[model samples]
Target: MKKRTAAAAMFTVAILATAAYAAHPGADYIKENGYKGPETCEECHPGKAKAFLDTVHWKHASKVTNVDGLDPKKEYGMQNRIYVMCNGNDIVNNLKEIPKNPETGKTKFSGCNTCHPGDHLNDVGSKGAEAEKAIDCLVCHSTAYDFRKRKPMKDDKGRVVMGQDRSKEAALAIGKPTAKNCMVCHEAAGGGVIVKRGFSFTKETDAHAAKGMVCVDCHKAKDHKIPTGTDPNNWANDGVRLSCADVSCHGASPHKDADLNRHTAKVACQTCHIPRTGGAFAKDFTVWAQNPDKFYEPTTLKLEANESSPVYAWYNGTVANTPHFIGPKGSKKDGKSKIYPFKIFQGKAFYNKKTGELLSMDFAPPMANGNTRAGVESAARTLGMKNPEQVAKEAVPGWQTIYFASSHLVTKTRALSCANCHAPNGVLNFKELGYSDKEVVKLTSPELFFNKVAAKMKEDW
Candidate 1:
């Protein structure tokens, strides 16, 4: 009795599942019409159908017009002029038919329409039309179209009107179009086929692709209007404005001025943000090799200082590994002393041993005249330092401040030292450490702490 009950329950569940699937209109449509082709859709959407006939996809699917100075029927032994590699049953032998140009009298096999199917056919079923016009939205968008359930108009007596239901069957009906469906043809050797204006037939295989993001997600109709170029006016639809810094898929902004979020006005996001074969590129900005692990955060920083005191600063970061800095230097006390030693002036200044001059200093106000307040006024002036300071604060907000005591004291010389700015971990941790990492890696000896730190940064950081 128990076994019989279990079998009955399983049978009931199967029937319910079948009924649920049958309810979906798409499934019913596919059942009735396998794939009738674009002609069925033309009956309803004539305008769209007309536009589709002008595309390249329709031309590829059509029968060969001429062959070898003769008709396709005379040239090829096949009954039909178009000899497609049929996946269906009835594999006819030697059915391959070569296409020819009627005007040039030259024989051609297959063209662009072989892959882009939309451009091969015409609305009127004519062969003279250009192939590019066949790329109809229905070929890709109409996943299913059912005419069986379509109801006829009702009369005043609530009876179905005769000849009112003019529902036509669809062609190539099946599952809905998805990102996976697009990839079938768009993908090429190792990656998606990139086309004019930075468009790709397939989605990128970077981290975003791995996460299952589709091409249409970011490159929506609105976003596609912007073409890749220096001149913004050339862009279609007056250009698409998007925040490259805010794209969640890419994670973070790669620009120094990313925090300002002012990129939308000057250039489209794809101009600098899109992935290229070599790397990312911008007009006058530096480019980086393809890096899949780059990360960014939207943040800001504030710097304040006094004449004798170090500058205080803070940041609000989203992720870990945020960078920080400390004091600067003035004059050297000993002959063999390192310019920016950890201790010495309690981490206040980094001195130069040769000329007994300060190499770097922490953030401090310039010495003010007696008329102005000494510490307070000088601190205010230092706080207002623009350009590099403002740029840095915007790039990485709340980042620790390493103030150079006085601009006049140090020689404004920039050194490529790992320990200087990066310290124990240093910029070596960066996937691409610019030229500074390469230079530092070569100069230091193997046993030196700086060398170990650089190696460790490369390994751990």
Candidate 2:
């Protein structure tokens, strides 16, 4: 029995050794050859090779040649200096000192290729050819875990095994283009260069980070083609459409006029609502509050109603002159001649009095206090009036005598504001209206409810 067990053990050891050899073919090759460079990959994928060369990434790593000499006032000026930002004790601190090759004392260029080593065509060359297409399929798509080196597990056959198949299977199990892939470069922990100002690099920094969302969620395409640009190719690109307002994740639209499907085609959602400065992207609302100049002020109006006095209404200074109400001619039933009270009931009274005489009382106000210009025009047409002035004259007396003020001025008045139509229930927040904010901190603050949106967005992505 002891002799039989020894023979079985010897057979298992032989099987395990053979399995290890098969799984680690590349490992031995890499150690001996030391990265032949991305040129080998280009042999299979040439289209991606050409596209990557045209990007800013390739330009950063391209060695200065006879045709690429420096010019003080030209494209090769101080702007071309590759100085990495040095944050003391920060993730980027390692980058402060110029990158040096351990084998050869040479400074490495600051470019995508630095992190994406698989894109280099010649590992030993001063400048490597762009191999983005090759890298995408090989490096980015592959798992980073060291699978080949892992110990093997035996099968029911009683044979020793290195589990090479299991390692490859495990790598393939992870989803592609996930936030996990993006965080590999975009996060500070992942050797990211983009530093967020006033905000630390944490899971909270990227709302999607916590929800396991990958970078590809928002930036869908592998290429750098933005949908809004003038490039005709962009029209054909099948990337994800991200809207600033009414995204499924936010649970509400931030745009005063949220049109989900159409808005993304017309504008970039992040241009206004997301804060890009200092590496932060739409973390909070404090940034918006501090940078009023970055965004467009929304049209606003305030209406105050009272039983005894003329209803008061005002709009933003630019829109204050728009007429809100009108009265019928000589219909001074309220004992006020030529002057109409800014009340819906008052207008109703004038309408009733004038319509009592005519077979059809077609008198209506030029516009209501909170109505938009287009809305007012539609209402006038519905009431059979040719213009706002005709309705104004017939519906109220002294309608033009009403004072105009900024919507902000009516803070003390008990009235409904323009938000009723423009931003009801926070559905139409002004930030989503393609307005950018310079104050990133304020725009991304918790008080602004940005996290709530981030959380929702992460889930949706």
Candidate 3:
């Protein structure tokens, strides 16, 4: 009888757990009527709408048109014609406008606004009018706006099929923006969570966020441009500037240990801070040599992160330029720069064998194009759909690399130890980083400790 009573209690607990998981009518709420643009929102909350018009998110996701055929900001190897034809030439307007086959008037780019909400069908052009139309405030301010939408599937009955915007329903019932809202783009980036972005940032974890200080606390935007660069106007260098040494947040003398303080100039605050990222699960990266999966539904998710240690590099702001790969700028010798931690995401994109150029794939949204005729024509997919028997087809599989600045997951513990990089078994191959193993070992030897002590002694005077 006691055992039976215990089983009943367990069943009641299971029901409550299911209710929590199915947190509905609150957020990720599907709007049957779809998203209403920023203009309509301005009527109720004029202040937020007027101010949000100037933000970097607005510019990068909405304002800037891919006018320069040569530069797509970040290289994906996919050519403009193939991308434009699939996602449509319209990079201007948000998602209210879905790109149609100018000939057939069928949907083309459906899930383009998964990151930036609004219309994509209408051409915003160089003019700001169309760009202004795409701003959806619930994206940033609403606590419930989880970045989700219906998978672009076609109806077999020849009926006009339409996708969904959960944010529209989410916008109706709203509150102040939380870390959850910011992660709509940050975490769900690069096709999946923990795939890209610095530290796979999440609200529930991270040191500052764990305490209660949210993203906006440090990353305060003035007129929507976040100033992280050496120079304020240079908005490109946004995320590189925050430090514990800064006067506003934490004063210059934050460290109690004078010995550790000397390493400040050479090493970044995050180098010692943010130790491990992702809650319970550590961060990692991988690329497919063959059988690449779809955009969002990547099957190769391993709970363990790729590298136990963050890659050390001299970070200034932007990464060093390359034909394909770009590294954040940091010099071994330059005093202005600091040795920072970086998260490396390794993935695959097709590359031309003869020319040695990295090939590109059209990164369409998750489950966007299935077996539909439009899916075959878009080229947004990789060769995963192709028969395995025809494996070594035309384009030879090549590897790709993405570097993210590892500064977000600011935890008090979990820093890399001396052996993690200096020892022979370390994650970083010294030779790959342009150094001999013995030389780097000697460089990180006891002398670094002694130098810190001496600097502390001098400060005492």
Candidate 4:
């Protein structure tokens, strides 16, 4: 009968293309466990791929060496816009080879491969061997990594082809790396965890990830470096980077008040101990309003959770606050400026109403690259617009705030006491915190400044 109706229409188009390849997001965990990338887990994990290629998360994908420099007239006395570095050019060298945007086919914003997914690495000199998407390391040592339910499917030589043996069943969901493999790109940081990481890393839990600790147990690493302790003289240089006071897990005066341990020489034990975080995700900004012709993809967004509201600034962790916003110096008249505590975020942007400016300079990650949708259409294609929501109603609106310095929650019963900033509807506003209205009437009359400091400590004892 006409060859059995063309063999029943090629067996119903091969069972509807295998039910549209099991609808992605780890596509049946990359087809029942298989992702042999990261070079077959570096052939039996070569010392965890040479200590995860000296991390910053596998060199944040590619090209990095712009250690965010500064000098602003021998230290913050004025103009240099007080240290905010997404890379303020110490050295970014030629570092090219991003290519792809033939009119937004998209790919050129190298703020680290949009968050180190895979298939890059072969620049900065060439002994070239890796890059067939070499560091997928089962998207961080798999907990059966569904790699954000990956729906990629490219091929025709465009690479990324997850069919069949799925890189050998994603190498049987690899071996170790939990904290659910580092919150699958850190709880969608800046684009997920309720839009730029705040309290509760989106839901992966913290307080040392619910008391089990991992993020390589306080970011561990030896000779391959990765310690980034942000200097206490390079935390005694065990290749630098390790502290919560060098992981005694809090004991360099874990505070029982020596006047909050004499404000840690201008504050920074995450400023008055994590006084706030992620609250309904402060000014959510709809996860940075992506849509340069609709591109925001944390595997197809839905995120909106948010929370946090602890803003009290003056950080002095040097210049533009390295690795983005160091909450330790708001120089309330700079005696090495202390008075810290900030988590602030308040949003609202899009400017340039015929030369009002401020459309994107502040977006900075070569134009806003937190986790990358081509760094949000390369800061809306470097603000030429092309239709970032048709230039948002002929644009012109401001307010940014940002200031993270949000060190994770530690909780000595939610800290922040001493009348939550010497109350009077507190949280600091002493003439918008420059103080001196006689120090805002002795910090808003705290019971007559503690009854004149308890009658001048009973007339100096």
Candidate 5:
């Protein structure tokens, strides 16, 4: 009788543990039978699959509702967007021209596709049921995600396309996304590790990361739609701004001192928190001039370190998304504007002399044959511009600037002191920020300004 009771207790404990494991997102639903495609997930979570299809994660585009100058009714994202990187061309845009691997006889997916979750080579070919089947659900959900398993696979129509890990372990390892899930793509963006976003989840850099808080703690996704702040180059989470001052976070008045809290109204949290970006290898400047040796490579590539100074600017949330011009929408005079930190990146691209628009070239093709001119013409043709060769001929190298908000790599302990911006030899250019000489002098003189606020405040400083 004693032995039977002990056996029963052990069985109950094992059953309870199994139930607890099933509580994770999609864990219970996804059977541990085998590694099927998104169709396997759709069998149980049809609505989830359908909802995810419309999200920016899958489409890589969203309605242009946030950008200041863009038509709100139209859609914008990686498919149609341009940036200072890669000669202004979005990744996988020119799939028709991308050459097939001689050995495989299969057109290998572009390097950018590694981070992307879709099975299709490019967005153009992915459509309808095919698109649904292409969604790699494991990439976001599975803790055991094996990115190395991503390789060429046959689609429904027997066409070979890029596919992600379909391992049984990945299928069974489904759960809510952790920081590792988000960082897998975010960390390795722009061709290399820790190159693009400069978001290395470490205690030394970020307070939130120090506490083992995941990105979703702040990003706060609702039905797979993650929220991010104002960024002209990124259209993913437009209009959905996440900030440290959110009521759930530090709130309106985070500081103990009333005088310091007043600055919160005019200064963004990131202004002091995120001192710099372009960590280690982020390309600060690139010139897309033709290279004789490597036709695909940029003429000049200048990388910046983690301590690189950010470009200070005034921001009222809205950013211009005009193809030819992109920047923040506010000046110092704007009542709603707050002082913000930005990473100002510059690149040289082929400018159309007649239309004043920059031409996006398909440099991927030229990599195979060492033909820069052909790459330019191929890109011009893809744009459907008249006289592709003529457009390439008339194109001239010109400078383009892109401003990205420095909102990550936050360090409360290492936050800038008041003297860093208020001293005589301060980092900020007061005149450039629209302050008059008199106002600048008064602002710069921290001692004189703090004296009138409170005697204790001056002593504390």
Candidate 6:
């Protein structure tokens, strides 16, 4: 009798789980047919597949039309993008030979495609029918996509790399992308949770997420091209600027206070909305070097962790990007400049002293045997360095910095108190922000507040 009762409980639990899954919109459609692959999706979404192929997400390359100091016509993306994070791209011929995770003890493929929506490795230029096959439709559209079902598989070159799940259930489970679909890759970018964007949108951080709004609601895509507003770290820009004052969302004058509304002319919404960031998961600095175990692990230093206030800067929607540095191109005196909040990322990268160029360190090569010299050589060759050996030989580690906009983790109703910026020990350093002593005094004075309010009231009257 006890054995029968146990069996009944197990059956009941299975039924409930199945019922929940069956509630998905596409689940009922499975009764008509089964999923074959991306071909199955193409049967219905023919235009969508073609449209997505043209996007930055599919090509991983873009004609950077909006960034300053870089050739706008020259296409740039992950193919040649380098960052101190991950010690640059970790591409290796044999993906299976890459080192296992110290924490998980599982050998996993950690390439750029690990977060990409496509199944093909580095097939950035794939188009038409070829791109449709290369694209992993279920990865983004299906609620039933299972990571467990995606085991390591062999690529066309017989190299063992990560695989995808296009099972019948995954195809049948196709639905509009939710936060879960987007966060699967975004949350894990730059190696771990909230690592890239110190405080990404979450239920605890963003008012939008708290209200169950997904990323796509704000970052709406047209032909899969999403707007990324002036991130110095990013290599591509589609020129579709995003603003808080959009007609569909917040209007020009959102605040009840006239003073606050006037401030919008010289201050971005994010400066006040994103009061603080990091939230204990942020890493402000990372130093990359071969570990004692011969595996290259980034030594992270959390200089500003656990809900730290942002570094305020003036921005004019332009950036200075080069091989060694990337930063905003706005000054306090710039008439077009507006105050913005930013999370500063600083890191160390290997630089070739001879060529005066930064060397990319392929983490996979060093991870296998801890030979950082070889990793540097591999990266130098990939970057078309004529003398890879000489470049690697003369490489010296140095620090670089990039500032990312703090545009998310927004509080709808919460903002920095006047004291947070106006007090003697305020968050912003007026001198560092290019303010003269006299200007700082006037800016921080209590009389400034009353004067502004009085002026606003007088104008209203």
Best by TM-score: 5
lDDT of 5 by residue, 142-228 (tens): 889887776655568766566588787788777678888888888766556655554577766678889888888998887677888
TM-score of model 2 (CA atoms): 0.29
What 10-residue stretch in candidate 4 is worst by lDDT? 76-85
Model 2 lDDT vs. the true structure?
0.29
The candidate, 2 or 3, that scores higher on lDDT is 3
The superposed Cα distance between candidate 1 and the true structure at residue 411, in angstroms, equals 39
TM-score of 3: 0.59
For model 1, how big is the CA root-mean-square deviation?
29.1
Task: List the candidates ranked by lDDT, beginning with the highest.
Answer: 6, 5, 3, 4, 2, 1
Q: Is candidate 3 or candidate 4 better by TM-score?
A: 3
What would the per-residue lDDT of candidate 6 be over residues 202-275, giving only the tens digit for each residue? 68768889999988888887766786666656766555667788877788898998778988887788887887
lDDT (tens digit, per residue) of candidate 1 on 209-264? 44565444543432113211111111112123333244543335444544223433
lDDT by residue for model 3 (22-90), tens: 643333323444446565555544655445544445434222121222343542221122221122211
Off by over 4 Å in 3: 1-37, 40-54, 61-112, 122-134, 144-176, 198-204, 227-244, 277-307, 353-355, 363-396, 416-461
TM-score of each: 0.30, 0.29, 0.59, 0.30, 0.84, 0.83
- Locate the minimum summed-lDDT window of 10 residues in model 2: 358-367
Candidate 4, residues 1-461, lDDT tens digits: the string is 99999999999888866664543334454354454455544444465554555444444322212123433223211011212112111112122233443445555332222344444333211122453334455666556554544433445866443222234545554544666676666665444454444555322334565566666666665533445543211111223545565635675666775766665665567655566665322332213444564333222122232245566666544423332233333467767665555555444434446665434322332222233333333445544568654444455544444455455655555566556667777766767767777878776777744765577679989
Instruction: Report the CA-based lDDT of candidate 5 relative to the real structure.
Output: 0.68
Residue 30, model 2, lDDT: 43
TM-score of 4: 0.30
Superposed by TM-score, candidate 4 places the C-alpha of residue 195 at a distance from the truth, in angstroms, of 14
lDDT of each: 0.28, 0.29, 0.46, 0.45, 0.68, 0.68
> Which parts of model 6 have CA positions greater than 4 angstroms off?
1-29, 90-96, 99-108, 155-157, 279-295, 303-306, 450-461
> What's the CA RMSD for each of the models?
29.1, 27.1, 11.4, 21.2, 4.4, 6.5
